[model samples]
Target: MNGTATHRTVIIVGSGPTGLLLAGDLATAGVPVTLLEKRSHDISNLSRAFGVHARTLEQLDARGLADQLLATGDTITGLRAFDRLTLDLTTLESRFPFMLITPQYEVERLLERRAREAGVDFAYESEVVGLRQDADGVELEVRGADGTVAVRRAAYVVGADGHHSAVRREIGLDFPGVSVIKSLFLADVRLAERPEDVLTVNGAGDCFAMIASFGDGWYRVMGWDRHHEVADDVPIDLDEVKDVARRALGSDYGMHDARWLSRFHSDERQAPRYRVGRVFLAGDAAHIHSPAGGQGMNTGLQDAANLSWKLAAAVQGWAPDGLLDTYETERHPVGKAVLRSSGGLVRLARAQSPALRAVRALVSAVGNTVGPARRKALGQISGIGYRYPALRGAHRLTGTRVPDVALAGGRLHEALRGGRFVLITPDPQAYEDPGTRKDRLTVECWASGRRTTVLVRPDGYVAWAADAPDATAIEEAVAAAVG
Candidate 1:
């Protein structure tokens, strides 16, 4: 490795959400991150994943970007069941009371801006052609816009590239899963009878239709028909996709010209492990599933957030090398759960027989029942149900994500703002500890009379909590977390 041209921390790909989020987090932590992308410029128009869940909003809030996101996107109060059944997610009790329905293009733009503002170095139109890793670090071979190749080195590397990740392939990580089903006709079209307010779903026969009004007259409609087939040579036509929508929704409803159209086949896959040697994977590179719960993109962004902090800690020499291993241990199960939930949703939508439809409706009804049952179902879809397994010697509440609680001064989430670890103590005296640094961990006093403690990460996830305030307990939790 030579002198001037090499980046201290180089990310081998893109303006995409996963890459950008990681870059932004690292940049904000005072880490110099070089983000290389093959795209010449930012993507202006793309109709990919659009639903941003509540948990993601909390993460964005920590970075001071939640208001910006909500301003641009519609606050989806709750997903409507069938056509008329609204779930009223505004009552769900989250920092973000509702899901943010913004297109993927906007998500990318927002993250890119945040990354730039945080000082992430950009190398557009540059692609990582090859990478060589040894005991020390990784040497990446890149080809720039002018077709000139150069070697870039970093202490570590991340494979945030998409489903067909070149980084994963180059690193030879195993992604085991299958293309479970192949049926698609996805489009963004203007409908004659544009459904006002909420999203809709009509599962009748092999005719599966899901439509949501992302404002404007435009609606994202996805449907499937078993008997109908696309010609081998023709890419899925917008007109064909719209015809399926018109047929499934109702023949009388005329489907007009579409703004965008594409075909998709669901794949249920996950990397065997998120990390191998010094390299790691995130986003679509680690897992890919149906977009039913809008979990695919959001999950990837969360992966970036989880890994960035651990990586920054490890690279800065403040944490144990084993801190990085927790990434896979924590996220792999979540990925498995996603595969199960999304795959089930897809199967329910694609179930053609009368018996299956009846069974699905009954299950849905049962799941939506009041109290705990309703909360669980809503939690699953909203990405709030996730909790990592507790570590050894952890308090009963430790490792369990802290419940979103209210405080007299502000909300528990407010203390977690600015992408830092927050230690919530019932006693304000914990702040007097001399060894504890304010910059590394912020101590906030909870006005709630309960003498409990909570530690939250930059992503707004509760990493550790205790039933009572104890300096030893808090210090141990901090050591476990950052170490």
Candidate 2:
């Protein structure tokens, strides 16, 4: 307990996808970030998540990382669920309209690389055992590999740890929710005869199974048995997994050579508050739910993206009042919605009663027949429907994610890689000189006949937009957003 205490700009606990992305973004913006992780530096081959949706791909594209990640994964233009409903991504309004199917480890690997390139200091083999925050900053008590305890102080602390987060516990936050399903088995193995579909999922009366290839020879299989209510530590037999798959999928596809296998229970839980003073919770530390729609890791990554810019603004001394608090106000609802949607999917898939199954079939038929309904459902699951609340009197485009527009320079997302707000105005003379706020804002003219002036946040959300030039409103909005 005698090790020296050190101070950092931000201390991020847990080096998962959320933590890594946040660290990379903050560090890229010149905020000093220290990442503390309990796991070793070695990357794991086994992965629980394998799909990245369109909105997430756009976020990655803003950082110039989508293509790199896309190269490692396969893509699916449509997804079928419940044996009747099909959600097509081809009609999505984005450069990447398909879901990228790759192991979660691939994502972590890319984010880790980005974080390292941004000069984020990683303290592996360090676990945060306690946290205390005052008016100015937070103090973390960390236990290192050799049993040495040290205090690390930071202006802010973010808990990106998994469900059992020490940081969340240290702050006395209650993770309130219940387990939705138990006795789910996860396995990665070789498929003797691969399915033609990019991802295949089905649920029978009492069981459900999903299989997706990693683009490699191995395929991931997840299934649940209604009768097997055993503890997580109980050994899983391949025969049992195949049995469940056969029951739910009607065939096991000659699965063999199990590389990894385990059992876990999915819970629908959310923290009462994402922020308690200067300590904030994100990713699984804030919310978790059933993996029915493959939304868990994608939701966490989006949370990191939403928070990184605000934290950077704070660290760099330009954040406006209440800007930091918006993190919880904006994201908590999204987290809760994800929990509900995923839970609903799980309940529908696990329904054993004949009447419930009939209801599922009816709903699927409606979803398939109704175009608007299918698009809405697809948007929700794919995250394209997410929109923040705009400021009162702001333009209608405010709070909406700006599409990747073609500009004179290049694509809209490509211009955002510099980590600065982009002001797109048809009238170049409508705004003040960029020289004054060059550190935080960039002025660009629309290449086409776009008469509207839009102020886009670093995260690609339209902060303020106007049909015509409003110099005074632009100045005031800029001040309120950046300072």
Best by lDDT: 2
| Per-residue alpha-carbon lDDT of candidate 1 for residues 116-234, written as tens digits (9 for 90 to 100) | 89988787888888988987788788898899999888878888878888788878887889875675666777778756555666655556677766665666777777777453334
Clashes of each: 0, 0
lDDT of 2 by residue, 1-483 (tens): 112233338989999899999999999998888999999897788968999998889989999889999998899998777878888789898898899999999999999999999989899999988888998899999999999999889889999999999999999999999989977889998988888787888888678899998898889999988988788999997899899989998999999999899999989999989999999999999999999778999999999999999988887777888888989988999999999888987887777789988988987998889988888788778888888987677678988888898776778898899889998888778888547578788778788988888889998898888786578887887777765
Candidate 2 stretches with Cα past 4 Å from truth are: 1-8
Error of 1 at 447 (Å): 3.0
- Computed on alpha carbons, the lDDT of every model, listed in order, comes to 0.74, 0.88
Scored by TM-score, the top model is: 2
Model 1 TM-score relative to the real fold:
0.91
